[model samples]
Structures are given as structure tokens and as C-alpha cells.
Target: MTRVDLNADMGESFGPWPMGDDASLLKTVTSANIACGGHAGDADTMARTMAMAQGNNVGIGAHPGFMDLAGFGRNRMSVPRGTLQNQIRYQVAASVGMARAVGAKVRHLKLHGALSNMASEDAALARDCYEAALSVDPDLIVMILAETAQQEAVRELGCRWASEIFADRAYNDDATLVDRSKPGAVIHDPDLAGKRMVEMVKAGAIITESGKQIPAAIDTICLHGDTPTAVQIATHVRRALEAAGITVQTFDGR
Candidate 1:
């Protein structure tokens, strides 16, 4: 049986500023990449989100990004390599300690926003960010964007990792994500998103917008929780995968 994990970003809500319907999203996703205060989320949100994930038996992950709360970490920034590494270490440590306090454990580490995009294209940067996280938890599972430099970093490091494809985002012919500013870059139609995921998972590759199939490992599918139709897309993707006889569960890394 073909199996894949469904993951969603959560815990982005700051104090008095709630973001993403985590409760509803948790019902459909098997794994959660929770924001660890670098881009979004706070100590309170982390504890609350971790508690919710533990109650639902969902796998928890530390989501660290560039410290740009004003930009939600989506805006790309140039930071020193050592600073970026320390940022990752700091965020992962916070996630690990908080999860322990809530009686939950963070099983994985996923880079967020611009940091993820940058790492997808730069192997050295990907290694630096992931290395910092691994320093905190040597057994941590690193989630990499499939068919990208992030994957290259993981392969070279010989660490446990999972390859991920996005359900709501379009792919370039080179397998990098289409820029968000482009038309049709972000798929909003739930049906289309669901159909695309089913196709990629069954083929064990990333089906680019140009109809090119880049052969890669498809261990998990991500549904961005900040989008308006994120929850709907996630629900449809789950149903579509199950309908096509694909098993959705937590990933054990590749």
C-alpha cells in the first residue's frame, strides 16, 4: 500500500491575533509544523497548540524561519550565516523545551517561509539551517522540499528526512515552487488541489505546471494553513487521497 503523510503549518497565532483554524486543520492533517516564534507564534500559542496536537495524537514539528514577525517571515531577507544558524537552534530549542513541558514531543523540524524557499535553492544554506536544528536534537527528522537543494542537503547529511510537496502551490519546470506573485501560482480551488496531490503521490513525483514529472520521494503533502481556503483544500486532499486508495499517516522520514 502506498502511504504518505498530510502536514499543515499551525500555531502561527500571536497574542490577540489568531491565525489559522488549527482546530479544524488538526482534524485532517496527521502532522503539524508549528511556528516557533521566529516568524509567528509565541510561548503561549506554542504551549496551546502543542497541547492540542498531543490530544489529537498528531506528530508535532518545530517550524523555524527568519525572525520577521512583521512580514510573517514570508519576505526574503539577507542575514549572516552564523546568525541564521543560531536562529534555528534557538527556535528548535524553544520548541523542544515547550513540548516537554506540555508532555508532548517535537518529532521533526521544518524550515518556514523565505528561509524554506532560500534553502530549496541553496544546498549550503539548507545544510546550515538543518545542521543547527540537528545540533539541538540529533534524532530530529528534517522535512525537505522534494527535488530541490533541501533534498540534496539531507542526502549529504545522511540524516532522517521526509520529502514534501505542496498541494496549494504550483511548481516551476525546475521543480521549485512558482512565485506567489504569479498568476495561478497558488491554487485556491479545493478540487484542483486535491486532484493534483493524488496525481503526484501515485506517481511518486512532483507534477510540475508544465506537465513535467520530476521523479522524487513523496513522503508528505503540505497544505499551508494561512491561506483562506487552506482547511477546505486539506479536507478535499485527504478525501481524494483516501478515495484513490492512498493511506494518509504520519511520516517516519526517508
Candidate 2:
């Protein structure tokens, strides 16, 4: 059977501000990328998310981001290779421990926000993050941008990778995401997003902003839990994929 993984970034609630509708999202997505005390999550939020994920019987993955909470980890920092590796290791370990505390195991390591962008484009950063996760737990799968540096590093390091695509985002000519600052960065219409997702998975291609078709591998689909209609988007995508005869599952069998 053809299978696809459905993942969502969870645990993004900061001190007093609640960010995504995680509880409903966790019910729909197969994998939960729990934030590892950086970018947007705190200890309480992480613990709560972990508990909720466990209750819903969902697979767990570590969502490690840069230590920049003010910019929500979207702003890149000029950290050395070694510093990046160490920070990634620390965050992954924290999430690993948190999962183990609740008798759950982290199925993968997914870098978030700026860290994900950097690792996907910079070979050195990709290798650093890949090596750090492998050292921490070689069994953990690495979820990354489909065609970027992290995927390349996964190939070189012989680590498992889940090629991920976004369901509600626009693609540039090069197949990378359009800059969020751009006018048409995100697709807010649920019906349009659902149709685009079906086309992306079934045909394995995305229509770029310039009306060019680019090959896309859809091993996993990501829905930003922080979006206003994240829950509706996920629900619609799941139905569309299932109706098209694709099995929506997590990276690791659950």
C-alpha cells in the first residue's frame, strides 16, 4: 500500500501566549514534532504536549530550533559549526528524555524554523545536525526539507530520512518555499490547500509560482499548527489523501 506520513509542529505555546490548536491537531496528524525548549516551547508546554500525544497514540519527534526565542527562531544566527552541533544535541536530548519520562520514544529529529532552513541549504550545517542526532541516537529518523542540505547529509551519513513537504505553503521556482514576506506565501483557503495537497501527493509534483511543474517527493506532509485554520487544513488534507487511497501514517510504524 502507498503510505504517507502526516506531521505537525506541536508544543509551540510560550509563557502566557498559546500558539497552535495542538490538541485537535494531534488527533489528526500521525506524528507530533514537539518543540525542544527553544523557539517556542517551555518545560510545561512540552510536558503537556507529550502527555497529550501519548494519550492520542501518536508518534513523537523532536523539533529542535535555534535558541532565538524572540524571533521565534526564524532569524538566523552566525554560530560556529561546533556551537550549532552542540545546541542541536542538547535540545534533542532534552526532548528524548522528556519522551522517555512518559514511556514514549522519539521516532525522529526534525530541525525547526531557521535551523531547518540553514541545515537544508548549508552542507556543513546539515552534516553537523545529522551527526549530532546520530550520535545521540542512531535509530532516530531525520525529517528534513525534501531536496535540501539535510536530505543530502542524510544520504551521505546513511541515516534514515523522511522527505517532508508543506501542505499550505507556496513554492518558488526552485521548488523551495516562497519567502513568507511575499504576498502569496501561504494558502489560507482550506479547499485550495486540500486540492494542492492531493495534486502534490498523487502526481508527485507542485506547480510553482512561475507556473512551472517540479518533481516533489511526499514521504511526509507538514501542517503548521500555529496557523489560524490549522486544524481544518489538516482534517481536509487527511480526508483528501485517504479518499485518493493513500495511507496516512507516521515515519515509524505506530
Candidate 3:
């Protein structure tokens, strides 16, 4: 049977601003990518999220990003290679510490937002992030965008990797995510989103906005927690995949 991991970014609430209702979302996804301190999480939020994930038996992952809290780590920034590697290492290590405190394990390392996109195309940034993740824990899986330079670098380091696909975002012919600023970039309708997800999982391919079919070796599909209809989209997609006999689980669980 084919299996795919359902993951979402959680623990984003920092200080007085509360983000997504992660506790509820935890019941839905098999894996939780908890945000570390760099992007959008605090010590209290991290502790709470880690405990909740442990209680729900959801596998935890470190979601590391640039140290741009003002931009929510979505804005591109120029930083030295060593600085990038150190920041990623600090965030992942912080998350691993929190998870271990609650008796939970850090199963993977997933880079967030702009850093993730940059790493996909930039060999230098990818190598830095890959090295940081392995430095934290050599056994941790790296969840990276497939068909990117980062995947190649991660594999060269002998670390396990999971190919990540987005359920709500449209893709270009080159298998890159369509710019969010463009029209039709995000599928907000739950039914349509469900249909797209079903097509991708069933065929192991997705048709881009330019009408080109792209093959994806998908081991995981991501649903952004910040989306308004995220829960509905996640629920419907999970049901659709299950009906098609695809098991939902984390990479480690598989």
C-alpha cells in the first residue's frame, strides 16, 4: 500500500499573538512540524506544542527558518553561509531539546518559508541547511522539496530525505510552486483542493498551471496551517487518500 505523511506547520504563535489552533490540527495530521524560535515561536509556545504533539502521538519535526520574525521568515534576506547554518542549527537544536523534555522524538527537519524556497534552488544555502540538520542529529530525516538541488545535497550527506508536495498551492511546469501573488495560485475551494490532491496521489503526478504534467515522487504533502480553509482541505484530502488505499503516516513510521 502506498503511504504519504500529512504535515502542517505548528507552534507559530509567539507572545500575545495566537496563530492556528494547533491542538485541534494535531488530531488530523500524522506529523507536526513545530516552529522553532527563529521564525515565529516562543519558548512557552514550543513547550506547549511539544507536549501536545506527544500526547496525541503525532510525530514531531523541527521547522527551522531565517531569523526574520518581522517578515515571518518569508522575506528573502542576505546572510553569510556560516550565519545561516548556525541559525538553523540553533533552531533545530532548541526544538529537539523541547521535544526530548516531553519524551517525544524529533523525527525530521523541515525548513520554513523563504529559506525553504531558497534552499531548493541555491546549492550553497541547501548545503548549509543540510549540514545544520545533520549536525543536530545525524538520524533525522530532511523533508525537502523534490527535484531540487537541496535534495541532492542532503542525499550526498547520507541523510534520509522525504519529498514534500503542497496540497493547496499551484505549481509551475518546472514543478516549482506558483508565486502566491499571481491569480489562481492557491486553491481555496475545499472540493477543488480535494480533487487536485486525489489526482496527484493516485497518479503520482500533477498537472501544472501551464498544462504540463510533472512527475513527483511524493512521500509527504503539506497543508499550511495559516490558510483559512486548512482544516477542511486537510480532512477531505485525508479521506480521499484513504479511500484510494494510501496510508497516512510519518516517514519514520513508514
Predicted structure with the largest lDDT when compared to the true one: 1
Off by over 4 Å in 3: none
Q: Model 1, which residues run further than 4 Å from truth?
A: none
- Candidate lDDT values, in order: 0.96, 0.85, 0.85
Question: Deviation in angstroms for 107 in model 3?
Answer: 0.6
Q: Each model's TM-score?
A: 0.99, 0.95, 0.96
Off-target runs (Cα >4 Å) in candidate 2 are none
For residues 130-248, could you state the per-residue lDDT of candidate 3 as single tens digits?
89878989888888886677777776776788888888999887677787789988888877776777788777876788767778778888988878888888888888888878899
- Model 1 steric clash pairs: none
Over 141-190, each residue of candidate 1 has an lDDT whose tens digit, in order, gives 99999989999999999999999999999999888999999999999999
> If candidate 2 were superposed on the true structure by all CA atoms, what would the RMSD be?
1.7
Q: What is the TM-score of candidate 1?
A: 0.99
Most TM-score-accurate candidate: 1
Question: Candidate 2's residue-wise lDDT over 109-134, tens digit each?
Answer: 88998888877778678888889877
For every candidate structure, what is the RMSD over all alpha carbons to the true structure, in angstroms?
Answer: 0.6, 1.7, 1.4
Residue 12: error of model 2 in Å? 0.7
